[model samples]
Target: MTHLFDPLTLRGVTFRNRIGVAPMCQYSAAEDARPTEWHLAHLLQRSLGGAGLVCVEATGVLPEGRITPTCLGLWNDAQESSHARLAQAIARGGAVPGIQLAHAGRKASRRPTWQRGPAEPGWEIVGPSAAAFGDYATPHALTPEEIEALPKAFADSARRAVRAGYGFVELHGAHGYLLHQFLSPLSNMRNDAWGGDFAGRSRLVLDTSDAIRAVIPDQMPLFVRLSHTDWVAGGWDTEETVALSRLLKAKGVDLISVTSGGLDHRQKIDLVPLYQVPGAEAVRQGAEIPVAAVGLITTPEEAQAVVAEGRADMVLLARAVLRNPYWPAQAAIALGRPEALVPPQYDRGWNDWGKLPVELAVAEPMPAL
Candidate 1:
């Protein structure tokens, strides 16, 4: 049985352990959608905290794709140059640098959440259909020609990710993003080649995976984050997610990082610990694909069992890590596997970790560009 601290390798890249810091947006980018200093300090600390991987936030693949005007982006050379520094800093801190390529669709161009009440849309948004996510502005339905162009846009971002020194790349198909807008029946009402059936709905993501895999070296893994369910009746569900995962595996995709329910404001989720693991487990077993379980998995025991019981291949954390950036090392100590807290950092509290196999830093993987 694989434990939480066990190393996991996908394609040719190796993670020091199975605990990854889930990509959580800081919404602190510059006006041009470039990552600011906050993005660097925020992620590099998680790397040093002993996370196996630290994924960058949901970055816009195009200007209009941003969730907020301040969200990170990857469409240009300057952005790539800026991100290279982030990737290198995370690598030096002993974690694999990964990025989530995203387009927020109808959810784009809102005020940052910290701004609180009644955030209005700053720009026109696009979606699989004109259906809006509750009170957000109704989006323009993308034409067939626009649909055909998106895969290359994602592919171009993947190419830039390689050039930026990201060792892992994930397509953000979850949490009511552009790809999720196409997958869920409640949001995507199109009858054209881009919508209607499962095959049609899946085309954008499949084409995107194909495009991204074509450019990135075989050594790097491509992950897709899937919203396991839309949580409303007659919406996207586990069965469809399983089928999609199988096809994704055949397309040379490495893993599914399972999350759920951001496509609709009408979604009725019963929030609790491990609420979404079953979804991840279903995708892993039914599809016979590796999956990373996310959503409310907040405890060490819960995270350990997810991997050890063969329920999921990896356990990703968000709020848990945000509350404690060194949750990985702390979990190691709690599990009586205290070696992860070693190297006797000059920090006073960590000195009593007793004896441990001081880990040498992992060498940076060759840049794919």
Candidate 2:
């Protein structure tokens, strides 16, 4: 059985541990999308705490695609340069730096989650149709020309991420975002070639991946995050994600990070340990592609079991890492292999933790306020 701290390689990239920090957004960037001090501190701390791969949050390809005015952007040289510092910082702390390229689609033009209000002032929200996401705001439909231009924007951002020293890039196709809006039947009411059937719906993401892969060198890996199930009836489901995984695999996607929901307003999620692992397993089995299982995966033994059982190739954590960035290092002690995930900087801190109570090792307060 491969332990969570074991090194896993894909293409030319090697992750020191199977543990990865899922892209969690910090809506603190400048209006022009430059990385603030907050971005550097948040990601660099995770690396120091022993995460193998640290993925920066959803960075928009174009200004209009931003979910918030303060979201990161890679559309220009200055923005790329600013993020390069962050990438270097993460690498210096012994973690592979990655960026998730995204376009919010109809979910654009919103205030950051911290801000409670009507939509941000003077921002345009775009989606596949003129549908209202919730009772919050109205979204404008995209024209055919705009749809054609979107892929080029994504490719452009991928190039910038590579230039910024990202070892890997994940195209954000999950969470009812732009690429996802095109894939889900409930959101995409288009009768044209971009919708109606599964092939047409998946075309946008596949073509975007192909364009991005063309620019990025083969040494750098690319992954796609898929909402494996929309959690609503007659919407994007497990079967569709399996097929999408096959297409993404052919387009040079190294892994599929399986997440679910965010397409419907009425979704009832079952919050439990390893709840989303099955989706990753299905994609891995049905599509013959590697998968990264996410959602409430909090323990080393549980993460190890997911990999050992062939359910997923990697285990991604968002809230779990936020709860304890040093979870990977602590996990090493729990599994009786303290030398693996522990860096030389933290060697002194590794005192017979294996003998300590499990509750004491993981009883830290939440990082997020």
Candidate 3:
């Protein structure tokens, strides 16, 4: 049986432990969509704090696909270079560097949460259908040709991620993003080949995965984040998600990061601890694929249980890690594996008697050469 601190090997990559830091948007990039110093600091710290896999946030494959003007992107050379630096930093800090490629669809072009209001006139948003998400402007429905071209766009982004030295790539098909829009019948109301049936609706996601898999090395792991449920009546739910997971697994996807909701405004979610683990379990059992569970998984014990009890293969921490970058280290100590992932630079921080320093480490001035 696997535990939280046990290593997980997917394809040719091995995570040092099962504790991964979920991608959280910083929304601090410049207009050019390059990662800023904030990203380096934020992601590197998580790696140094002992996360097994430090995933970059939902990065736009196209500029217009960004959730906000400040979202990070990899659609250009400069952005690729910036992400390369981040990938190196995560590796040097002792963790696998992964990235999530996304297209926000109708949810694009919104202001960051800190600056919420009407967005300045921006590029027209595109989706499977012309639907407005809540108060957002109606997006233009993508033409069939545009639909055909999307997989290439996603493939191109995966190429950039390989160029940037990412160990794995995750296709963001969840949280009402472009791919999720195609997956959910509620958002993709169309009568064409790209809609109206399960095969039609799932075509984009499968094609994108195939395209990405073709470009990346065979050994590189590919993950997909899917909203297991839309949480509204007549919306995409666990059954379809399971079917999609099976298809993706056949197409070379190694893992499914199961999350839920955000496809519809009328979503009714009961916010409780481990509320989403069942969905992950359902997908894992139905599809026979390794899965990662996320959603209010705060404590080390809870995370360990999810993996140890075979509820899920891994647990991703978001808010808990944000509050304390050293969450994994603390967890290691709590689980009686204090030496599991302590960085040598901070060896003094942990002792055999469960004593831990309040701070990770203090840098002393270098002696004069």
Candidate 4:
């Protein structure tokens, strides 16, 4: 059984442990989608904090695909070089660097979440149809020509990502983004060939993944984040997701990162610990490939149980790591072991736990650090 601290190898990349940092958008990029100094520092800190793998945020393939003014981009050479610098910094901290290429569709061009606004901005959000993302924005419908151009954008970004030294690439196909918008019937109301059937609705994601794989090297691992269920009636469901996962596996994807319930603004989800674990298990069993589970997984014992019982191949942490960048280091102690994933700077303090129980160390002084 694979434990939380076990190593995992995919393609030519080997992770030191199964714990990975989820790609959470920093919203600290330049207006033109270039990576700033803040982006480099944030990722480097997490890597140093002891994650086996660090995935950067959802980066846009085009200017209009950005979620906010400060999202990263890989559509140009300058952006590619900037990302390469970020990758170098992450490597220096002893973690494998990864990137998530994304297109927000109707969810694009919004003010950062820190601004706390309710209305959509003036930018034109484009999607498969002229539908809004639950009153978020009015998207412009794409013609056949425009729809064909979107895959080229994805391929161009993938080529740049290889040049940027990313060890892995994840296609952002979940959370009601551009590809998810096409997948969910509730959001995609197009009656053309791009809609009205499972296979037709899935065309964009399949074609986009194919185009991306064409540009990236076979040695680099490729994955996709999928919304297993839309959590709404008459919307995309688990059956469709299972079918899609098998198809994606045939398209040469290595794993599926299972996430759920972002297809609508009025989504009523049951956010419980390991609520998404079953989805990951479903994909793992149905697709017969590795799957990463995320969502309210805060404890080491719980994460260990999930992996040990064959529920998931790995665990992804976003907000948990934000609350404690050293969560992995603490997790080792929680499981009654301490190893060298900790930086040498913290080695002296490792002995300071004198006579305290491991549970006390995990409960009392972890998040405060």
Candidate 5:
């Protein structure tokens, strides 16, 4: 049986283990959307912490696509150069560097959630329809010409990612973003070819995936993050997500990272441990593609069981990882796999751990990035 620490090979790239750091936005970028020192330190530390794959957060493909002015972007040379440094830092710390490309669509032009107030007026947001996401501004409906241009925009950003030295790329088709706006009927009320039935709804995502694949080398695995359900009646659900996964696989996507319910305010989710694993299992079985489960999987045992029991091929940790960047190493020790990746500087600390009781095995202080 595959365990959490087992290496996973997809296409020509192999992740050292089945543990990944789910992309979480820092919302701390400069006005220009370039990665700052915080990004470099945050991602590189997680790499050193022993995650097999360290994914940069949702980076915008266009300035207008950002969820906030502070989100990272890859549309310009400066941004691309900044990401190259981050990629190298992740690699140097012993993790495969990955990035998620996204467009925020109707959800754009908001203040950071921490600011806790109304968003200041900014650039117009665009989506499949002129619908507003809750109280946000009603986005302008995208024209056919603009819709046709989206794939090229995605492709261009993907090319920049390749140049930035990312070994893997995940398209953010989830979380009520632009692609999810096109996929979910709740947000997409368009009657054109870009919206209606499943085929129409899935066109933009499929086209964007194909466009990205056309530019990136076949050896570089591509992953897609999907909101497996909208958690409301008559909305996008697990079955549709499975079908979309199959289509994405046919278009050369290697894995489906299953996350759910960010498309609507009406969504009713039962938050619990492994709440989304079943969705991953359904997609993996239905689409015959590897799936990475995410959501409240905090402990080493829970993460291990997800992989070992064949529930999902991998598990991605978000808040848990942020709470403890070295969670992977601690998990490795607990699972009796002490050979897991540990930096040379930290070798003495882990060596002492074997002689000490579990409660006494404290981690050494991390060095400056």
Candidate 6:
């Protein structure tokens, strides 16, 4: 049985614990689409708080891939340098640095939640089909030529991530992003070789993974985040997600982070704790692959149960960690592990009931090809 406190290794990267900080969009980048001080501060604090891995938010691979105007990007040299700083900061703060590369598809060009009104003009929004996502901006249908070129765009971003020193790379194929748009029948209505059947629809993500895997070091782990179900009838479902996970595993994906809904506005998701754990377990068993469970995992006990019971290999915390940056340290005390989280400077506050070895070191992965 895997304990939540046990270190989890994927390829050459070793997380200090099963607890990971899920990427949350800061939406604080400037017009240049580079990391701002906010990103470094936010991510570093979480890393210092004792999370094993700190994944940067969904970043645009191309300028137009951004969901909002201020979202981060990795396409340019400046952005790559900025990301390098963020990645190194994470490592120094005691966590493996990770990044999620994404394209928002029809969902691009929308305003951030903090912002209001229609999206400002002069941005191109593209998707698998020319359809719009609910009341969002209508998108131009990507030509097959453009679609074929997308894998390279993603691969190029992966290459930059390698140089930027990210230990883990995740393709954001969920939450109605561009890749999810292709997977869901509701979004991808094309009749070409790029669409229609399951194989055709899944081509982009697979190709992107293959391209990245081929270029990155053999030791670096790659993860894929998938919306296990669209939660609407006839949309992408858990059955297909399981099937896809199998294929992704065969294609060199190390883990599948499972969550559901977010494909369509009509999606009807049940509100319950651990509602998505079953889906994660299904993919893990059905595909015989390592899986990360995310959703309403709020407490340390809940997180420990998910791992100890073999439902998921990891539990990613977003809102919980945001609520308390040192949740991992607190969890350590609750779970009877040593108070190995706080740094020497803050050691005086924590009770010294026991001691557990927690190394703030990341395994050295080979340089990118």
On residues 88-109, what C-alpha lDDT tens digit does candidate 5 reach at each position?
Answer: 8888777899999999999988
Q: For each candidate, what TM-score against the reference?
A: 0.94, 0.93, 0.95, 0.93, 0.95, 0.94
Against the reference, the lDDT scores of all candidates come to 0.89, 0.86, 0.91, 0.85, 0.91, 0.89
Residues 71-92, candidate 1, lDDT per residue (tens digit)?
9999999999999999998887
Model 4, 1-369: lDDT tens digits are 778888889989898788889999988888668889898878878887777889999999998888876778889888999999888788777789999999998888887788844325447789988878766767899888888888899989988988888889999999999999999989878788778789889999999999988889988889899999988878888888889999999998988899998888777789889998999999999889889999899999998898899999899999999998888878887887565666656655655767323321111111111
Query: lDDT rank, highest first?
Result: 5, 3, 6, 1, 2, 4
Tens-digit lDDT track of model 3 for 1-369: 888888999999999889899989999997799998899889988988888899999999999999988999988899999899889888877789999999999999988888885458677899899888888889999999999999999899999999999999999999999999999999999889889988999999999999999999989999999999999999999999999999999999999999999999999999999999999999999999999999999998999999999999999999999999989988887787753466656666555446664334333232232
Worst 10 residues of 3 by lDDT: 360-369
Candidate 5 clash figure, as a count: 0
The list of candidate 4 runs beyond 4 A from truth reads 118-122, 355-369
Q: RMSD in Å for candidate 2, one decimal? A: 4.6
Model 1's alpha-carbon lDDT is: 0.89
Stretches of candidate 6 above 4 Å error? 351-369
| TM-score (C-alpha, index-matched) for candidate 4 | 0.93
Q: Number of clashes in every candidate structure?
A: 0, 0, 0, 0, 0, 0
Error of 5 at 103 (Å): 0.3
RMSD of each: 3.1, 4.6, 3.1, 4.6, 3.0, 3.8
lDDT of 6 by residue, 1-369 (tens): 788989998998899999899989888997899999899889988988988899999999999999888899999999999999899888877889999999998888878878854568748789999888888778999998899899999999999999999999999999999999999999999999879999999999889999889888999999999999999999999999999999999999999999888889998888788889999999999999999999889988999999999999999998889999989988887788864577665554553544444322333342342
| Candidate 4, poorest ten consecutive residues by summed lDDT | 360-369
